[model samples]
Structure formats: C-alpha cells, structure tokens
Target chain A: MLDSRVLRVFREVFDDEQLAVSDTTSARDVPDWDSLAQVKLVIALEQEFDVRFSTTEIGTWACVGDLKRALRSKLGAA
Target chain B: MSAPAEIRVSLDWGGGEPMIVRWLVADRAPVKRGQAICEIEASKATADIVSPADGILVVVIPDGDVRDQEVVGHIHAVGEALPLSAAAVERGPEPDVEGGTHVPRSLRKAAEIRTLEEGRRGSLPSTVMQQLVVGDLVDRLRDGGASLTALVILAVARALRKHRAFNASASDTGVLLHDAVRIGVALDVEPHGLRVPIVTDADTKTVAEIAGDLQILLYKYMTKTLEPDEIRGATFTLTDLSSFGVAWSVPLLVGRQAAILGLGMIRGADPRDTMLTFSLTFDHRVASGREAALFLSDVRKRISEHMVSNDSGA
Candidate 1:
C-alpha cells in the first residue's frame, strides 16, 4: 500500500504515468529523478502521506525501498 | 561600407589574470550583433565575450591563453572580405614552457593560484543541485519590497548557522570554523571580469540590511572602488545567474572556502507556481554528500516557511 502511494507520488513528480517504480528503484532508474525531482518527491510524499520529515529523516532516504520502509514506520506510529 | 569592427579582449587589471580563451561560435561563421562569441576563463571565474556587431567572425588569434587587451579576432560585415596575413595565420598554438612564449603576468598569476588550490585541497569537491519552488516567495518578496537575492542570502546564512562545517574554511594547520558568517556575492562585471564582494557578518544582518549592503557593494564593484577587504574573507559564496536565464551552473569552488552556491533562473508560466534551481559545490573533505543535501533541504524549508508566514500575514 505504501509502494502504491509512493508510486503515485513518483508519477506526479516526474509527470510520467508509465514510470515503473519499485523497491529497488533509485535516482538512476528514472531519467527525471534529479535533485530537483527528489525535492519535489519529498514534498509530494509529505503531502500525500500527511507526514512531516525532519531534515535528518529527509537525508536518510536513498532508494524507493528506504522510502517505503520509512513511510510504513511513520504511518504505524501515527 | 564601414570597416569591420575589431574585437579585442580588454584587460581587467582588477579582474582575473591570464584568462584562457575559448571560442563559442566557430571561425568564419556568421554571427549576430551581441551574440556570445567566446568564453574567457581566469582562475575560477568565467565570462562570455559577446560580439559587438553583426558579421562574420575572422579569428586572428586561435583559442589559447591570452593576456588582457590582446586582439583575439575581428568581426566583418556580410560579403566583406578581409585579407589574412601570413603572420596571423602562422601564429601557432600556445607554447608549453613559460620561456617558449611571452606569457602574460595575469596568466602566470592564475597558474600559481591553480597550483596552490590543487596542492591545498587534496580531495575533489562534491556538487548537489536542488530545484526549489519559489513562485510564492518571489511574489511575497516583491510585495514586501525585497529582492530575491537578498532573501536567498538570508536563507543560506541562517542555514549555515546550523551547519558550521559548510560555513568554515580549511587552514594550514586544520579546519577553521568561523563564528561569524560572511557571504560573498559574485557579480558579473561583463567585458571586464567577475568580482565577488563579501557581505560581512551576514548571519547577524537583517534581510533589509543585507540588501542595503549588497546595493552598496554592487555600486562599488561597478565604479572600481571596492577595497581589498570588501572582496576577501568570505565564509560562504553565492552567485546568481538567473538574470542570464541560465537553468543551472556548477560554479568552481573558491580556495580555502568550503562551499559556493549558484542560483539559476526562476521559471514558470504562472506567477504563483515558479521554481528556482540552486547548485551547491562543496569541498567533500569538509562535508559529506548527505550533510550537504540536508543543509540544502533545510535552507529550502526555511525559505518556504518564511514565505508562507509572510503570505498569511499579508
């Protein structure tokens, strides 16, 4: 479920409905996943999941799997 | 028909020494008036040499290291033919040794500076770019009678207070982190060279105060009256290339300083939805990639939060 929402955010950030986002997906996996895109992804994720990320938490994400795990933990805690 | 205008590289005694010249437009190519014809590099600074008239480019000097006030080439009107002297054509590339050719003093100074930077900084710098949504902030600043550059300077200065590593510089003995934040603003004094005047104690200065200082600094730079102390001892540096419509640029790191931030043009169709791209080049030895990214994120967050609060208050 977290993956689905993350994927939706990714699609919105990249404006690519056909982007195949997965657990292993990294910046290199998506052509448009640049630094700017990364920031947009973070903002979109925050708005989508209704969770705020601390600066340290924002820096901890390296891949889609990491994002998924962090979102799951935050959601469970909420 | 009027004689073809002679395009020469004007020397900047106060600018970077011995600038390397690179032609942007090809030789003998038709070019427009005011089109960027070449780029000149001096030390870590670069500037574009624009054509003065619409015409064909007749390169008298090929791309190589050039001194100030050297005649690099000429621009001729369409269908006009200029004779190329054998001596001009035979002028070969720059010789390897200093003794082989008369090297300009500025070029030599630039070389010495390059050697020093390479020797002092053992590791290569890491770069990170972030696209920040700033349409609302730009609007609010305009409404509040504030410049975007002043806002960015304040935001970066505030963030640097939290990340001391970036606000510090490398010394001979060790890393020296300064308590005061002095930010340098890079100005493109075109047809001359780039000049960076420092805004001393930026951390303690209000946005209006910084903007006032920036205006005075820029005025000094334009009039060639800036004191040596005004251009030195910056804890951090910021260059805004947005006026040129540049999307992004990776600015060269200044010696001793740990980081430099470049602000690209803010672009968007809607006034309420514009975004600006910022590129940060930091000395990796001082800060890791994550720290830099987080620092940038914090700066962005602070700017956004400040702007949102302003909007609500207004």
Candidate 2:
C-alpha cells in the first residue's frame, strides 16, 4: 500500500515519476524540491492516505520520515 | 571511488542579456562531488545550482536564448558519464484535467471593476506596508501611473492561455475558470495583517491604466476606506514581502481560489543591487506542483528580464 501510495503522490506532485519511491528518501535530497513542491506533496499525500492535514502540521514536515510518522499516527488512530 | 572534480560554467553576456544554464556547477576547474557546478541569473537574482550527479564540466549555451528551467550542463559521477546534455534534465509535465469553463472577457472586465468596488466597501482602510523598492512601484505612485501588480496579472492571463492550469479551478460538478486570470495583490497594512486589492482584466489593461488604478487603490487602502467590491472576485492573490528582508513564503490558498503566490524580500549582495524572492501555493486539485513551479518560474523570468533600475511607470 505504501508503495502504490508513494508512487501516486510522486506522480501527482512531480508528474514525471509516479513510480518513484523507496525506503530511504526525502524531498530535501531531491533536486526539484521547493516550497511549491512541498505544498503539492502534502496535498497529494492527504489524498492518497485518505487523511487530512492542518496547514501547521504540513508546514512542520521536512522529509519523508516525518511524513511517515504522521501517517502512522493518523492512520493507526483510525 | 574517486570523487568528481568541480567546475564553474558561466554564460558570458558580452555586455548583452545574460543566459541561464540549467545544469548546476557545470563549469568548475576540477569539480568534486557535492560541489556547485553552474549558476544562472534570471534577472536581479542568481540561484547557485548544485551538481546533481558529480561529473566533468561541459558547457552547452555559451550564449543563446535558452529556455527557462532547462538543464544546460552536467558533471560526471565516479565511473559514470562525464557531462549530461541540456536535453536530459527535463521537467515533467504538470498534472491536470483538460477542458472546462472559461471566464468570459466581459465577465472578467466586470470582475475587475467589482474587485475594486468590493475592496473599497468591507475592509478597514489601509495602506501598503513594507513598500517594495521596485522603482516601478515608486514611479507609479508618484506619477499616478500603471501598476506593476496589474502587469503581472496580465502576464498570468497570457500564461493561462498556454498552460491553463493556473487559470482553471475545480468546481463541484466540473471546472470553473476565467477566460482571463484575475490577480489580487496583497497590500500589507499595519495592525490588520494583509489586505488584498484587485486589478481587473489585467491582461487587457494598458500599463498606464494599471499604474493609475493601483495608485487609486493605494490611496483608498492607506486611508482605511476600501469598499467591499474592491476585495471581492479575486481568483488568485499575491502577497509579496520583498520590501522586508524575508526571502521566501508559501501563502495559503483562499476558498474557491486556485492559487496564491507569496513573495519574499528583494535584496542584493551589494547594498545597491535589487533582487526579489518568490514562492507559490496552488490548489493541488487544480494545478500540480510542477504546474505551479513552471508558472512561477515564468513570472520570475519576466521580472528578471524586463525590470531595470529606471524601468518605472512604464
């Protein structure tokens, strides 16, 4: 599920690589990462994980690990 | 493995307009891994591009009208290729659905008027805060001339004709759009945060009209008597803090709006130089990140290319 979800979000946010996901990754390490990319990533993740994120929460995430932790919390609680 | 050496790729202007290279650190003498390869200046500001995959430096456009956001050079990774060509570092297409409502020209003109009217009615009267050092803004206010904000909006409208993503938004049943892009400039007023004022059918308005209308809006906003119509009907809002030292910000998108652009402080390394920082936040449902990036990059390119120290009130 994470595989599919990550790919979907990647495609939705970046458009070039829908199949781009791995165990070790973060937007910071990506060359195309920018503020616009961050917002797009959050919006895409919210749709993929079927979870909602407050602006404040989205602002705090800097990498994929933090997003994964948030996902676990939101999805696990549900 | 031996690390790659660094290089510095420069676009010599020969006293003409400078061209931007897409590859980062593409011109180091003996480039190393993780070193900056090439640097490109879009206008007043230069982004120090880093080497993506370490490699040998090779230049492509010594001087050409290279497209914005295209990679122009590259380095060789250890046991890898030396230099990647400009065609390789392509940005992917933006995600979006095709075809929907188009904002009519008549509607757009009315919307412009209505925007100014709305701004005048509901909000507390305010003035522009953190006045940007852009000479155009200064001259317009002084001569009661055209506004930079309006010109920017018009440019967006033109871009929408081609890209369409920035101009379109999601509606419950289908897509809602304006044939023209309506842009609202967020005027920071003390005590009340930021207030947006509209500049109508910016695409069609003459530079003189924009400057004169913006002056009127500034007066009304500063006096604290903006009408409700002036603030309403904005499809997009822009908040620029280039007057302050802040470099970048991502503004929140308003309800029913497709996008909002945030601008950071403009500064130069030298006290006398002018530079601007820009950022964009768009409704993902309407335009994906790639779309927003391309649109904003276009805006940056226009400003960097057109703006000069004396290019005020024009």
Candidate 3:
C-alpha cells in the first residue's frame, strides 16, 4: 500500500506514468528525481499519509527504500 | 493625532524570509484593526495580515518581498493627514506603461534599474560571444521534444557551476560567490513586457528535467500564478532574442551580478548544421574578457555535446 501510494506521488511529481520506483530506486536511478521532485514528493506523502518528517530524517534518504523506512517510521509514530 | 500603526511581518517562517505576497485590497482602502489587509507568505506558511488599527491604509512599500520588521504599509486615523507628505510617504507604483499593464510594476522597475544602470554602477561591463554550430543536435533534440531555450539554460547552469567566477556578484569589497546555481530566465510575457523568473539549483537537474520545470513555470506565467519568490533571487540572468532574428546582443547584468547571457536566433543554411549566437555581458570588476571567453567556450561545448549525450542515452 505504501509503495503504491509512494509511486503515485513520484508519478505526479515527475509527470511520468511508467516510472516503477522499486527498492533500489535512487536519484541516480530516476533522472528527474532532484530536489524539486523530492520536495513535491515529500509534500504529497505528508498529505496522503498524514505524517511529518524531521529535518534529520529528510536528509537520510538515499533511495526509495530509505524513503519507505522513514515514511513507515513517521507514519507509525503518527 | 496618534501615530500611524506600522504593518509588519512578525510571523515566524522557520528562517525563511517572509514577504508581502500581495495586497488584499487597493492602497488607501479603509479597514478595521482586525481586517485582513494583505497576504504574506514564507517558505513555511501563508497568512493574511490584519490591520493594527482602524484607519486609511497608506501603502508605502506597495508590493514585493519584505524583511522582518520592515514597514510595508501604515494605517492612519481617518481625516488625519499622513505625518509625511503624501508624495513623500507612499512609494506606489508608477502609471502603467503602453503595452505593459499586465506586468508587475516592480518587475518593470527592476528591469530598468538593473539593465539601464549597468554601465554606471561602478561596473565596467564587457561582452564576449561565441557562435556555436549545432544544427544536427538541434534537429535531433527538437524531433525528440526538447526546447532550445531549456538546452541553453542547462548548458549555462553547468558552465556557471564549473566556472564559479561567472556566478558571483561584484560588490564594493570583492566578487561574492554564490553557492547555488539559480538561473534567472528572462521570459517575454508578450504584451505584459519581460519577467525574469528563476530556475533554482539548475546545475543539479538534467536537461529533460529542466525542460519539465520550464514547462511548469511557463504554465504558471500564462495563468498569472507566478509567486514573488520565483521572480526574485538570481545568481545570473539569461535572455533570448533569437525568435526575433536578432544576431547578437549584450545582456545586462541583474543588479551587481557577475554576468548575463543573451542568446540570438539559430542561423544556418542547412537545418542539420545550424549555429547559435550568444553573448555574455560580464562585470569587469569580477571577471575579465579571458575568463568570460573560457566560460562561454564551456557553454558552447556543453551545448554541442547534447547529441553525444543523447546518443549514449544519458
């Protein structure tokens, strides 16, 4: 469920429909996954999942897998 | 007569500079103390600013970004004249110019102040240009859905990153280097005049992504939804006049910024072998002709390499 929702956020942010964000998905893997996209993704995720990421947690994401873990933790805390 | 209450931005925007997004009502409109007079926004939050006291709103700093405790406007009691003369008190925008009513007056003023006064800003302005041959690349990129403007912008961003001297501002002291590669793009809003919206952190984005960003910004401009933040803060400015068939032009620097690039129309007999003319006007206090030449050479090289990168599927 989280991956499905997270992928939707990516799809909307980059305007790409076929982008399959897997566990190994990183900025290197997705060419358009820059700061702007990340900001949009975070806002969408916070809105859909109703969770918040701290300043420290925001920087720890190196890939989609990292993002999942952070989101999972944040969602659980919420 | 009581003193005119000052309108200030006291909201905490988490270190993000809060500014007057827009006035809710026209200047000099009557309002109660709790009435929302204008909208203010920071990176973190957006809120309507209420009047401090019941009075006639004498807008001083009519619009644009404002610092903390900065007086954007003031509210004076009815029937009481402004402490200062009306002419000296309100710095409202000038009358609309011909074919430029849609454009924000501040933006037009900014363009005038930055471009017209470059020669006398104690900055010895100089220009260096290069004619880049990239007909084949342009044809390929155009067929594959790429904007010439976006391509040039990305190339310029990369060049600025590699050559930080062009990304600096010359001050009374020395050339102050900027950490971020925020490219201010001069967009012709047609009858609205010219607007310089920025694409921030441009060096970190790929050409395709930059195109996508440009698309969104373009849509925002068309819809008149561009924010003040997007229009302010430029490490460097880029203006293109190629559509008009102009050959070469020296783009004036924004404020004390180090350099500005003017792109000319693509020219060549063969569509597959076209050449683009671009000139970079630089602050002589910050960089010399040699440095400007090297920077333009890099921009030219990066632009020409578009084919090779696309061929390699980068």
Candidate 4:
C-alpha cells in the first residue's frame, strides 16, 4: 500500500483534494504535475518521508512505483 | 513646413525578404514625432516604424508588400493635404479575395504573428542550456514574500547591465546596443497565444519593485487593459514554463532582440535546494556562443549571491 503521508503530500503539492495516486501513476496522469509542480512535490515528499534524494535519482524516477521503491530503500538504509 | 518626410522601409540589417506593411495610423491622421505609425513584418522580425516628425500621416501605400528603401508613406506638416497621387486615397477599399479559401479572421491574425518567427527559423540560433541550482534563491524569496519570477528578472537585468551586446538590435550599420534594459515577461494569454509585457528599466529596480510592476502588468493583460507601451520596447525576454511542468524549452526571439531566456521546471533530490534548466537562444549575428554562456553564468552567479546576501541579512 502507498504511504498515506506520501499520498497526502501529493494532494497538498497539487492543491487538489481529489488527486489519487497508485504505484503505476505517472506524471502524465496528473494535469497539474508540471515542472514547477514537480519541484513542490519533491520538497513536500522530503518533509513527509524525512529523506533526501540525489539529483541522479530525481531525474530517474518514472512513476509513483519508482518513487515508492526509492523511499522504501531510503527508509531501509536509515 | 518643409515637404513631408517620406517614411521608407529600410532593409533589415540581417538581410532577408522584403517586409509586409500594415499602417497603425490611418491617412490624414494627425501624428506626433516618434509616434508608432506602422508595423513592418518580415519573415524574421517585425518592427514598428515610427514617425520622424510631428505632422499628419499620408499613407502612399495603405497596405501591401514593400521592399527596402521603398517609400511606404509620409508624415506631412499641418495644412498639408493628401497628394492626389497618394494611392491610399485613390483606392476605395480592399476587395475581398474571390475563389480564395476563406480563412477565419482569428486564423489570419494568428498567421500574421507567426510570420516573423517563421521567417527567421531558416537561420538557426546558437542555443546554450545550463542547469542552475536555485533552491536557496527560491527559499529566500518565499521567506521574504518576494516572487521567484521577479528574482530571475533582476538577475537577468544585472547580467545585461554588464553585457550590453546581448541586449542589442541588428541595424543596417551594425548591432545597435540598447542603453535601457527592458525585460519582456512572457505571459500565456491562452487561446490567443502569448502576450509579452515588457518591464522597462528593470536594471534600475529592486526585486520587490519589479514584482509590483509585473503584478500590475499581468493583471492588466488578464483584464485586456494592457497599453501599447506595456507590450513593446523589450531588449530581452524571459518565459517561465515551470508551472506547465516543462523542464526545458528553447524560447524564440521577439522582434530584433538578441536573445530570449526560457525557465524550465525546477527539480531536485534534496528538499532544501533544487536545480532548474535555463535555456538561452540568441542571435549568432549579435553575440557568439561564448558570450551567451558567459551571460547565463553571470545571471546564475548574481542570483546565487543575492539570495545568500539576503539570507544573511534576515
């Protein structure tokens, strides 16, 4: 299951209460998930998960599943 | 007064095809010196031809294709009548094209706007893209109740002050550098294409001041109340596509301006700071690739340093 905090962060970053994200959800799935919005999303995610991402990792994630896996790895490492 | 000064379409310094003439002022209209009388459109550039002397406008050619040094119209002194030989008076009205595909007025207007860029597409620009780390700047602005767009404008203006060559126009003599740093902020007017409102004398203003001006200009544009002056006189332009999730875009040059800067989406792994790509497309005729790179570097340095200074003060 996707972390409730991560889902909450997405909703907050997009400023949409109805936004739903699954493991397979990609940037194309969200209308407001643009470049500027993506930056806000990263900041929100860091605050929620208490994890930092590298530039290489930031550029590689393709969907929510990739993000979830990365988050899981970061948490495990911690 | 002396004979009316003939207004001619001068050949574009960066020579290309002849320009299409469209008069802004009508025949027999009283005009002031330096008033924008007509707009000349070539494939690469659209220039507003202004009146040289205060007088009455007498259009020799109401609307048609005109070549270099060809007399398009004249600015006559008061009491001077339209010459009988003036073709505008002779021609009753523009006839509708028969058997021609009927184009919507909106479509024709859109085509008119694209002609200038389409013409110059043949001469490809030298573009340089660099990823700027602007996390600290963005955070500082958010803390100070300032706008990120305004910060970018100030940075660009600062860089332009040092490198005037990037803020220049192509002239018959050479590249004519502008003394004033007017930065055009590209606003998507939506369904109507883009409308760029120029922030005049940006180099002289603070970030807060520039933000205030942009707020007023953007509101005017949204309300359809923007004046002609607000939309003209830009030496450089900035288009931020971050909101649209665009990572990078090669922005097109407006008019005869030397360069355009595009702000892409900001991304970062770390929450405290992020990286955004700044794409600059410049006229190779006015500046070389090295000069363009240096200008971007200067902008990046200025923004970084300014934000740091502001943070320490707070």
Choose the strongest candidate by TM-score.
3
Per-candidate iRMSD: 16.6, 16.3, 10.9, 14.7
CAPRI band for model 4: incorrect
Q: Model 1: clashing residue pairs?
A: B17-B106, B18-B106, B18-B107
Please tell me which predicted candidate would have the highest DockQ against the true structure. 3
Question: What are the per-residue Cα lDDT tens digits for candidate 3 across B1-314?
Answer: 88889987765544355666788877777889899988887776788888999989987655555655656689989998865433343345555665644443464464355344643478888998899776555444433434577788888999998889899888878988999888988877555557677998877887766766775665455445677678766889989887568888977777668889999866678775567898999988888899899999999888767756676222
TM-score of chain B of 4: 0.65
lDDT of 4 by residue, B1-314 (tens): 48889897875544444455577887788999989998887656778888988988887665555556767788878986667545534444566765656443353343334434532654347789888766655554543435678878998998998989888876445788988888988887454456788898878888867766776666566556676567766788899886567889987776667788999866666745567788998888778899999999998888777867787211
Q: How good is model 3 by TM-score? A: 0.55
Worst lDDT 10-window in candidate 3 chain B:
B83-92
Candidate that beats the other on TM-score, 3 or 4, i.e. the better one: 3
lDDT (Cα, tens digit) per residue for candidate 2, span B1-314: 44543234333432222345354432433465566655566444565556555456655443233323343554545455554443332222533877876443342333333333333332222111121334334233223323345455555555556666656554545557767566778776554345677877766766556545565565456545566557656766777665456677756555456666666655556544444455666656566666666776677555544455235534
**Candidates 2 and 4 compared by DockQ, better number:** 4
Stretches of candidate 4 off by over 4 Å are A1-78, B1-115, B118-124, B189-192, B312-314
Writing each residue's lDDT as its tens digit, candidate 4 over A1-78 gives 347888998989888898899988876677555334554566578778888765445534568888889889998898
RMSD (Å) per prediction = 19.8, 25.6, 10.7, 14.9
For residues B65-102, write the lDDT of model 1, one tens digit per residue.
55466657789889987767423445457556666555
> Which pairs of residues have clashing backbones in candidate 4?
A34-B245, A35-B245, B43-B119
